[model samples]
Target: MSSSRYLTNQFLIAMPGLEDPNFFHSVTYICEHNDNGALGLVINRPLEMQLGEIFQHINIEHADPDIRQIQVHLGGPVQQDRGFVLHEPLGDWEATLKVTDRIGVTSSIDILQAIAINEGPERTLVALGYAGWGAGQLEQEMADNAWLSGPADPEILFRTPDAERWRAAAASLGIDLDLLSGEAGHA
Candidate 1:
């Protein structure tokens, strides 16, 4: 595959030995990639907070009794204060990016309100911040083996646990992350 190919709707699974704390053993869903740059959300790094905390912070009273059940992830290293929603059943929102036929990403308060009252998309993953790369940066990372690219699988995104997502995403590509050698050498 060409390193310069558009990666929208694909998954970027971080390889082992990635020392950067923000991306160590991470699985990011590429929402946009092109000549300009690339943007994605790290899908695994769950934070200590949940949707309830977010609603309260934004002055949106949440009625869902299971609000605490929701998870909030650390999307990436940039814009850490903003919220981003990766969801399904693409619906109209103040601002939304249809990442795929089954997935969408929203960065609007209206979507958050819908989620607060249980009227939001059925499958949702809320996150803060997002991973970003300047022009050609992502391709360079790919060439360096910092990440393995794969098709974005919603099952792995919504069904897998936070700590297991990285490995699970890699598994989808028939890769056992445990077996990857950290040393840069070919046998």
Candidate 2:
């Protein structure tokens, strides 16, 4: 809403005063943002389960020892039982949303299977569920100063630890979130 431009492939960092339990101190990676609606995944809320457990539940024998212990994340509140995989390289999957030239989201079982066998994209963030907003809903929220949109850094998605992602994403804008007041205006 700031300039009539969409926030596709951006990171929506929760403001200091965000009271919503689902979004407080959260960092969401916007996979698709446009005229109809927007869909994203919370990048920092890791669930109790790990990649190995998820693969087992789905009856897939995971072969990637390096990522077997990688914890899955709670992407958002909606579709809590469904799984989403945010990765790079825009590979051909049964169902996918190309977020940017370097990022893509896949919800297909095939992609999961590929990942279990170590044949998937080089980097992946396994998450359950996703965040969704109706047409103009996200823009309105931004207008009300509920969030801060910034460039999506793949490092935050793949490298940074979850406990620190919220602060790190906010810091990516050169503003220390800890120093911000609870009562903020437009971001």
Candidate 3:
């Protein structure tokens, strides 16, 4: 098999006809890719939960309404209850995963508090879970045309509207999303 490391920290844009309900029109950001497998976060799927709701559930006082209004995203299918904050690189944290030079994922309360205080990283998207693929599963999926890979764009991930993320990511690769077909089989 080829090395998965090459795809690390890349964007995996779902093909036009992806049948999987979970990944249909999904825009996933590959956080770690290696021989073991790949892990990523679905950046485009936002859950109904809001940051304020989460703060209330966790008993964390959210004094500022702005912080509470931040949308909570659906990170992935696994560990749906867990939280993953994809944010701009700033401040210290307990467990932080640097997704790129401009983006980082923090799973600590400190980051949350910083966000509540409006003193956190300038760009951030709070997710409720993360996507995971077993060994070689992602590579196989990519080979099968289930996804298109491209470089990560902080603006696309954090700034672009969720409704347009799929097209934007594909456009970054010079792909016209409408031209893509769902059928994975090729001649």
Candidate 4:
């Protein structure tokens, strides 16, 4: 696969044919992609718990009701217990993977601490776990039409409602997923 084909900072909109329980109808933000594999966070699946629950679990006291009510997303099926903070303005963080100059995903607790007190990045999407693919695995999925790939849009990531992200992401590519068949074609 050509290096130019790497999907970092892109959106992987699951194809209608993808039947996996974890990814069906999901729109994943590709954070890192290279010869090693791909790492992404599913943006659409919000868990029942809110940010307040996470603060309580981590023993961080926060007084802002707006911050506490933020919905936490289920990023993917992998490492479901770990927290990942995807934020904009890419500030200095302990363990952040800079996907682009504008966005970063931080796993360190310090970012969360700052978040609890409203001193963190201006826009953040807090999630648990992440989507990962081994070397060549994602390429194969692409060839098999498992997803529609396109440049990542911050509006969809930071502002779009969880329930609409799937369609919104596909729409970004001029695709109406509702019209697509749940069957793959071999050209």
TM-score of each candidate structure, all chains considered together: 0.94, 0.94, 0.93, 0.96
Kindly list the per-residue Cα lDDT of model 1 for residues 34-106, writing each as its tens digit.
8889999999999999888888888998776696469899999999999999999788888998887778999
- Cα error, residue 51 of model 3, in Å, equals 0.4
RMSD of each: 2.3, 1.8, 2.3, 1.6
* Candidate 2, residue 44: how far the Cα is off, in Å: 0.5
> Please, what are the lDDT tens digits per residue for candidate 4 over residues 68-138?
99999999999999999999999999999999999999999999899889999999999999999999999
lDDT (tens digit, per residue) of candidate 3 on 42-127: 99998887899988887877788888989899999999888988887745688888766767788898888778878888889899
Best by lDDT: 4
Clashes of 2: 0
Q: Is candidate 1 or candidate 4 better by lDDT?
A: 4
Backbone clash numbers for all candidates listed: 0, 0, 0, 0
lDDT of each: 0.87, 0.90, 0.85, 0.94
Residue 138 of model 1 has an lDDT of 92
Query: In terms of TM-score, which candidate is strongest?
Result: 4
lDDT of 3: 0.85
Off by over 4 Å in 3: 1-5, 184-187
- With candidate 3 superimposed using the best TM-score fit, by how many Å does residue 178's alpha carbon deviate from the native? 0.5
Error of 2 at 45 (Å): 0.2
Number of the candidate with higher lDDT, 2 or 4: 4
Cα error, residue 87 of model 3, in Å, equals 1.2
- Model 2 residue runs over 4 Å out of place are 1-4
